[model samples]
Target: MRERPPAAELDAVDRRIVDALQGGFPVCERPYAAAAESLGIAEEELLARLQSLLDRKVLTRFGPMFQIERMGGAFVLAALAVPEADWARVNDAVNAFPEVAHNYRRESDLNTPFNMWFVLATETREGIAEAVRKIEAATGLVVHPFPKLKEYFVEMKLAVRGEALS
Candidate 1:
């Protein structure tokens, strides 16, 4: 078998592009042009860099996070304690639901049993329980729901390590 090629490395310009658009993305008719102008690069270059960053897995997502509750929708956090032997099967069963928005695997401490966590998005608040029921029935594991008590707006922005970004 051929050895896989090494992953691409991020350069100074790529680092700037990653850090520059962390909190606020341009919202103008020519948003790319505006953003590119601010970064001292052409719109085409910026677009290319963004796509490359995505392709390299340096950036997982680049978009707005919607406040679903404002639109009469509900987003619930739920989890399950999946057995190691049945992880793949249980994962498939849970992800089969249309209401599932995001799913994650968590390392459980000595006392905790819940290992799989996910978010459920539904059109109505009552739909949360129904989704939980469906997931429980499908996975044969008890679903634990954690309702959000407070919301905080936190922007995740960081300069490249050992580099003076500002």
Candidate 2:
């Protein structure tokens, strides 16, 4: 896979676009047009720029952020100590499940046993456990689930200037 370009490569227009759309998006028939107008750019330009950003991997995803728990769903963080040689197989096996929202491989820490981590979302709390069991059965590896116990306040507004903001 190709590495994503650095944020420093983003232009002023790109920065403005990222900053303006980071917050709540407009709920209108022509949402893009409305947003583009607010950003002082043409609708077509806004769409094209967003597409380019996505294609370049500058923006990993652009969509609504849903509160699954509030909507009678459950989300959990799960991990596995996948052997280096079996990384691809395990990744594919676990990600094949629809409940697997996303997964990433992390360097194993001396203190932690698990190296691969992923988020699983399901329609119910029981579904979370079921997905974990399914993944364990499919990969022949135990899935350690870490469910959220307390809520934390997090502000996710990122003003992607010509520099890293994350």
Candidate 3:
């Protein structure tokens, strides 16, 4: 059994900062500074706290979630089946491609159906297809590429609210 980490209490100020940064960071060049002003804290302090939270796993990820359609970037939704013996090695090889945003391990018949799944972002359909091909060749396994026909909605926000929003 895995041991759980100790719970850390968050003060009002910390909650405020976390809530402010939950949705997305400001798109401007000085995002931290903007977030600092909105949270009523010094820019440096905001950076420090954010770093601490990241180190502590309070924030799993903190960055931009690009609008691929608006940016003319192709989003390839894909999955792969790997033998249990090859799961870890194949997962690492597939994720080595920089275009891969993130991947997840899912339970499958081969021991896991989508033992590996990820999104590849590129400027063209052909590019994404090529990436899938390269990943398959590199991993010595079949990769099922499923390019998204449309994006109905992407719900990513998860804020622990109660603090004021600026």
Q: Residue 149's C-alpha lDDT in candidate 2?
A: 94
- Residue clash pairs of candidate 1: none
- Looking at model 3, the pairs that clash are 107-112, 108-112, 108-113
For all candidates in order, the CA lDDT equals 0.85, 0.85, 0.77
Those runs of model 3 whose alpha carbons end farther than 4 Å from true positions after fitting are 1-11, 23-33, 60-63, 108-112, 161-166
How would you encode candidate 1's per-residue C-alpha lDDT over 19-76 as one tens digit per residue? 7888678687999899999999999999998998888887878888777898888999
In TM-score terms, which candidate is top? 2
lDDT of 3 at 118: 88
Estimate candidate 3's alpha-carbon lDDT, on a 0 to 1 scale: 0.77
Distance from true location, Cα of 5 in model 1, Å: 15
Q: What does the lDDT come to for candidate 2?
A: 0.85
Q: Answer with 2 or 3, whichever has the higher lDDT.
A: 2
Model 3 error, position 70 (Å): 2.8
Backbone atom clashes (below 3 Å) for every candidate: 0, 0, 3
User: What's the candidate order when arranged by decreasing TM-score?
Assistant: 2, 1, 3
